[model samples]
Target: MKRRNFLQQTAMAGASLFTAGQSAAATPVYQQPADNPFNLNYAMHDGMFRNSAGADIIDQIKFAYDHGFRSIEDNGMMSRTPELQKKIGDTLQKLGMNMGVFVITSDNWHWKTSLTTGKQEWIDKMMTDCKTAVDVAKRCGAKWMTVVPGNFERSLSFEYQTANVIAALRKASAVLEPHGLVMVLEMLSDNPDLFLRHSDQAYMICKAVNSPACKMLFDMYHMQRNEGDIINNIDKSWEEIGYLQIGDNPGRKEPGTGEMNYKNIFKHIHEKGYKGILGMEHGISQKGQEGEQALIKAYRDADNFL
Candidate 1:
């Protein structure tokens, strides 16, 4: 099957998890930022896919840059060829765009294994993988890498699992700290059956790791699904949140398409002086290049309220 078809199917399977809610507070009619002062950045995975039209990846980078996104995130960045990585890094640097989080964990596929297993072999492998990820980050000048602690260990006690995750992260932090790399633990919402499903959980994990190299990747859509208090939860966990991601709840589409007032959220984060990228890890509501252009327009429109 084509890659897009596969992704659509994957999204559909995860769609039912979101319970419907009120549409985002009516765009909060307001004036725009002076020449757009919001410092928001968007992830490139879906947006680039929509705009590229099978264009070369470099052209895809140009497409996103022209569209007003100041950043990009690739979950599969580690899998890209070294040459491709260098090329993307060079292009992004030239455009003055930031490289956002890429995956550093082993459980990226349809598997279940927590990094907190506390197994010597697992810990060693993770450190080795993170060391490699650090090299990629160095080349791309990326600061954040996504780290999913993996699925719940049913065989172990919850306390044991937490301890294991903490130990593993402590070891992982050792690898990233010296290089000024951060591992942002993403609290995924798709698998509620697994661990790390809420902002509080992520906050606790960050606190436990207790290192600048360990922080939270607050994915807004996921957090909205896992817990509804968007603003309050952010306030509570602000200190540990190292990165932010965007996708509205219900549809997991562009911001305005669902129940998220991305404008106010952007305004809040911007006003708070969050310098990190807001990864646009979402899908376009429409199809193909038209949808891609629409996504850009939607960001411009929503961000105008800033």
Candidate 2:
């Protein structure tokens, strides 16, 4: 049978069994595990369990929550229809799950001159995007959104570029702060030409912006690839870090599938009293349902450090 049809039939059968006072063993539906077994709030993204949950986004979310995840993040939330966004927000609220960061995106975001040029047009676009983000955040119950300052303008001096980024972010912050939302600056390792490539750089920009809405997203995968001392960098940038993302280095996969020791890192973050969500922003190491199951087991093993 088609996956969606099968899922619908399974749900109906499960409801019938429960209504008939049938024993749990009589139902053939997938059993839910204990909720949130991990000490930290690890946020899973959509498509992470498509093989098991089918194509429906809501079903995928319910699957994640049922399998011991307490948070969810979608990088493309802004592009979703308003109706879908509201449904997502309502569902998350009903499940009592935390909503994590979505990218603060725009058409001009990819241009090298976007933020580093210090152009009014770019800043205007950013401000407009920020205002739009406030609405998106309200619909999805998200407190944090990811911001990338785009590529570097080589013609401009490093100081000038930094100043431009800080100025642009300051404007964006003003738009977000009043609404109790934050734009977390993510330092990526994907492109060397990217202006924000280091933790200290992101921290400096956040400090220069100096607003509650402007903070850093200390992604462990990027930091591990960009700089080896994950724990030390996190400590140094701790004051400015508003969010965290996870992916094992060398493979950019789930915990235990790569070189980085996630257990120790998770333990350290928990010890430091971080109550925020850590986004599971990576690919599954294996394929199909087995891969999804292994991904959960990897997190469970890594989270055992507590």
Candidate 3:
């Protein structure tokens, strides 16, 4: 069944928010402050507001908009049916919000045929995924696609591995460039075996790809966990970076749940005048409507950096 149909079939699509400690008249779980817009485009994913909006992806988008969110990103969007994809695109267009990165090919998260392997089949898959991404972007008004270079090949020499990744990226870039879509490489902290693990490494790969379509994602949570020099690395790679993903370390939740000073970080990015989307890619720290409301307040608090 299409997600849209499943949503309508079950009332989960329109579940109302109730207070955590007190059950009052059903009220929205989140609402933006009177000041209206925040300084940056913090893109939220489907379940970020699910406690309030239930399982309806469209309702979640509407709830985010009502609370001042102006962008949405779904990493698994490519898997969504085209009709659902178009519905999401139309809804975002009507709200004048941005659509952020969806994964080009993340099936390699479990150590599959990575770019490092220099395998013909893997390279062909990369090209095919990039081509598929263009049509996906066209239907959904997306301008960015997330690309993970996959895990390192244990037997391959590091130099040859780097060369193979650059070659694959160049080919993928050709497919995305004409459509004005960017392929942003993400650095993961979930595993040490991953090929692309640092901001500078991604920056180097982006430079080697040498195309406007190639850029760095600069996910703060992973980088912070992998390497502690967050602000400095961000400054060094500022030019090559295209997007940002935020999560508090220790636990991958919204800001303030961990030790990182997101207020200062937000201030730094805003000071540099970054105009792209910063994806809230983490889970909520608290559960239910109260937790959802807390997540909005967290952004509000962090955005106070300006």
Candidate 4:
């Protein structure tokens, strides 16, 4: 394994242990004072800052908050122990920071279960998973959960596949809607074979579901890869988009390291009156604390355009 990946696994293992003793209501370590400039809506990914803080989740949260980040996103929020999830939620709420998106359908990717399969077992498992997501979301005070519909089934026609996806989402929406939680379908450009690849497709699905709880997680990195018109596509799907995720193209690294014009894009999103979190799902291209600091600076520069 690569040294960096090994180090990451080690750090996460250690920090996951440390969170055992901290009370859910413990005072948050990193609350920004009222005077900070960039306190609006930014998120921190768990693995990205592990190297900088020796795997302490609280320390990572504090570090991000002190540096002006007001939100944090953990894709594996449901996988953590209940105590840990409560602790994380308590810290963010106490610190006045928002909790960002967590996963609702992780097993779909892991077990190769496509919603387009139209099998009773897959539908049953997905509903059970949504119930689990609701419990996690309640504990973490999270309002948005990420959903991926999985790969396209080779046996199905394109139109049939679309209909199958819509049916699955509509069923998922039933559970999420009653709990006042929204499930944002992520359009991943990373996998071309996935059912949902474009903003328009996602928008169509969201409309088909016809629930306030169904929306799109418009990821800039993947969108930039799948389609080039980032700003315009966002505007076109503005009404249906519920959340945003960030990573620059070419490297999947920090925001400023690639070709996307984040400043202008952020400005456009801000102009549209978006009040949700932007999940910082990219990696720091450089090594050590300095590299992490550089990533922080990049967000500040891009976010300040507002």
Query: What is the C-alpha local distance difference test score of each model?
Result: 0.74, 0.82, 0.82, 0.77
Q: Per-residue lDDT for 1-306 in model 1, tens only?
A: 222243445344333332232122112123233234335766676224432323355755665665556778777678778888888889889888889988886445213565656677777778888889988997776889988777777888888989998998998899999999999988877755567788988899899889999999998998888888898899999999999988887888888998889899888888888877888777767754446557777888777754
Model 2, clash count? 0
Quote model 4's TM-score: 0.88
| Sliding window of 10 residues with minimal summed lDDT for model 2 | 19-28
lDDT measured at residue 169 in model 3 versus the true structure, 0 to 100 = 91
lDDT of 4 by residue, 95-206 (tens): 8898999878654352264787877777777788888999999898899998887778889887887888789888988998999999998887654577778999999888
**Best first by TM-score, ranked:** 3, 2, 4, 1
Q: What is the lDDT of residue 17 in candidate 2?
A: 26
Clashing pairs in 1: 43-280
lDDT of 2: 0.82
lDDT of 3 by residue, 193-271 (tens): 7888898888888998899999999889889999878999999999899999998998778999999999999999999
Instruction: Give model 2's TM-score versus the native structure.
Output: 0.89
RMSD to the native, candidate 3? 4.9
Where model 4 places Cα greater than 4 Å from the true spot, the runs are 1-34, 37-40, 106-113
Better by TM-score, candidate 2 or 1: 2
Q: Which window of 10 residues has the lowest lDDT sum in candidate 4?
A: 1-10
Q: Which residue runs does candidate 2 get wrong by more than 4 Å?
A: 1-32
Which digits, one per residue and each the tens of the lDDT, describe model 2 over residues 1-306?
A: 211232244334323323222232222243446554569999987777666666567987887888788899888788889899999999999998989998887653643557998989888889889999999999989999989888898899999999999989988888999999999998888767888889999998988899999999998998998987999999999999999999887877899988998899999999999999999988777765567778888888899985
